[model samples]
Target chain A: MPTPILVVDDSVMARKMLIKALPAGWDVEITQAGNGVEALAAYRAGKAEVMFLDLTMPELDGYGVLETLQAEGLNSFVIVVSADIQPLARERVKQLGALAFVKKPVDPAQIEAILREYGIAL
Target chain B: MNDQLLLTPDQRDALQEVTNIAMGQAGAQLAQILEVFVQLSVPRINITESSSIATSILQLVGTPQSVTAVRQAFSGTLRGEAMVVYDQNGCRDLADLMGYEDDIDRDSERELLLDVGNVLVGACLNGIAELLGAKLSFSAPTIMAEDVEVGRLINPQQLTWNYALLVEVHFTLEVRDFTCHLMTLMPEESIVALKSALDAFMENL
Candidate 1:
């Protein structure tokens, strides 16, 4: 079985773009979560290896989910996919143990670069 | 944020003019992203009660089409919220522009909206930041269904029922079926400073 990857965000469009940007034939099982609560549940259920998370969400945010995941001792890599590219936000997510921070207006090349750098092979 | 109250009238006008220019750049960026010819009306500046913003936005959008809104908060030398509101129908146009298939999933919608909001809002805020010799950082956009009742959009603590200065812009794509509005809000105090800023900018021009 391929590695399970989780995509967490509140917007349907954001998830779609992220999925589309992924390398074809990755043989990865991509799961979706609408919010942090759902992300947590999906993480626990699937033991996902990577998570593409959005920062702002109602009823639990990306940061909260990361903290919870840490508490649970789940070591999945987190890649923040957000429109806001504030240096502080980048630092904050990095401190929280995220693997990468990709700003929005999703660039396929950037996404590919990050995925490859992270060894997320297709 | 508190410093907005201290700005002189001249500073205010310059600020407003700066916002106008900033919005113009943002509009251009939107056109580029969508790969459509966009006609954007010069922004109209108004300082009025927060309750009136929705009405103002509706007036700008015209007709009762469902609105798809994305709001993001920005902070730096100037702190405020920027929002991009598009007609629900525009989604299909955006999807087509991105070359996505017709059967786009929920995830695709979120990503597209985020990109849309980022281009419009980011460009506007960044434009202002550059003009003012300040740095601004934006938060991720939060999508919401436009509440015709403007009361739903206000932050009770920051704006309450007090006045806000609104910079509203209307956008029309040349050949596409997409149409939208961009509204930027700031506290009433900023209006005075913004007006002054505009005046100075004009004098220099």
Candidate 2:
């Protein structure tokens, strides 16, 4: 089975854009969680090698989810996704061990670049 | 300070013109992102005391039992507040257009609100900044329900003026069958500068 990647965000629009941006033939199952709480539960249930997490949420936001994952010592390949292009959010997420940062209105080219950089064949 | 000093008649006219162009650009940006045609009427401008702004803006967005509003502040030669208000139901409709699944929870709602706010407000500010030949920065958008009193939310002290120039923009999302509005408020001083800038640009052309 290909790596199980988790997609975390509250917005359906954001998730749709993420799916569209993913390279074709990734050969992976994408599971989605609406908020940090759901994402934390998803992480605890199974190991997802990769996650695309949104930063701002009402319950267990992106940062909270990252912290939860870290506390459990799960070393998933995580990426921080947000519409707020503030550098502070980026630096904070990077410190939390997110593998990458993707801005919304997700561009296919950027997704491809991240995939290439991470050496994931999709 | 006399609040009237903040804007001359020419300045008011210039700000109106700028807002007209800005709304058009915002409409175009939305259409491009949604991959559908959008129709946005030229915005109407008014200068009124700050006390009445919230009621006026709310009326334009329509009376919904629940509304989700996104606000961002920008500063430059012109400093002001910009808000995009939509019915929460409208947001879900937008989510559907963006391809979100049928079920959307609270967390997803927040994310959707942020994305919606980002694109719409970002595009609006970007257009205005470009037109004014200035750089703009925005704080993270906060989403609130209809119960939130918008007028009270705007700090009177921050305004430093008794009156504000309000720009009301009405727009339609063709695919989604929803209408939204963007309201922009700026200090009288900013209006003065904008007018001078517009007049200068016009003379140059």
Candidate 3:
């Protein structure tokens, strides 16, 4: 079965860039959400075995999604993808249980390396 | 876009996303400087007539109020001016953030605002230029207007351009009351360069 993935962000362009950056060979089923609210709904709908999330968004943000996931003990692997690259932001996301953080203007090779480091099954 | 805007909706969206990433870097710099989380809004781009920019600005500032604004001109693959506007209370909050609690005088307050304008505007413009793979140089930021009504912030006669593309974003302090509107106004000539730069960036992605 292909790994289910969720890419969430308010910007259509951002979502598109992220999708393009995904490992080309990874057998994945991709789902997208415009904000944290939609992301949670999609996750509950089983479309997010692994989630790539953006921080600043309308309706609900990435931090809210991470907090919700932690509160509910949902262990769907989450990798935060955001333009907010502050060290404190990174630390907070890590503390909130994000598996990793990737800065925006997503790099394909970086995404692949991160996936590999996490030992994600492609 | 009465002039039959050169930018399509798709292009506008792409530019806004690019501006978002750039502003994010600027916000992070602020957060680091003040030791407070900075709240960044989604970047909004508007193509407006220079004759009516004041109206757009008044709408942005919301309800006429005394404000301070700083302006810095930049030149490169893109050329334009960056303006940072703050309400009086926001200026006070920024002063408080910098520990200027001892009854800041007029000159001191203006200086403080200019310093902040440099920090936020410089980082944001630099980030955009870097992302677009363009070289940009900025003149020193100067106080454009202080303690003026939003409607009087910019004189139409002083404007050199007929049409401008304004990229606007807001940054708010998470715990403090500081909020500022950062706007980069690109004139007709600069808009052509910006569109091509934006196109090149989108192409790479």
Q: For residues B58-85, write the lDDT of model 1, one tens digit per residue.
A: 5666776566778888776556777777
**Candidate with better lDDT, 1 vs 2:** 1
Model 3 chain B: worst 10 consecutive residues (lDDT sum) = B1-10
Error of 3 at A63 (Å): 1.7
* Complex DockQ per candidate: 0.01, 0.01, 0.73
Candidate 3 colliding pairs: none
Error of 3 at A61 (Å): 1.5
User: How many clashes show up in model 1?
Assistant: 35
Off by over 4 Å in 2: A1-122, B1-14, B62-65, B144-160
Which of the CAPRI classes, incorrect, acceptable, medium or high, describes model 3?
A: medium
Docking quality (DockQ) of candidate 2: 0.01
Tens-digit lDDT track for model 3 on B1-205? 5444578776898888888898889998888778898888888888888898999888776789999899999998888899999988988888788888769887888898898889988889888888888999999999998889989998878889888888889998889777899998878988878888878878887
DockQ of candidate model 3: 0.73
Per-residue lDDT for B199 in model 2? Answer: 62
Model 2: which residue pairs collide? A10-B107, A10-B108
Task: Tell me what fraction of the real C-alpha contacts between chains A and B each candidate also makes.
Answer: 0.00, 0.00, 0.64
| TM-score for chain B of each model, two decimals | 0.78, 0.80, 0.95
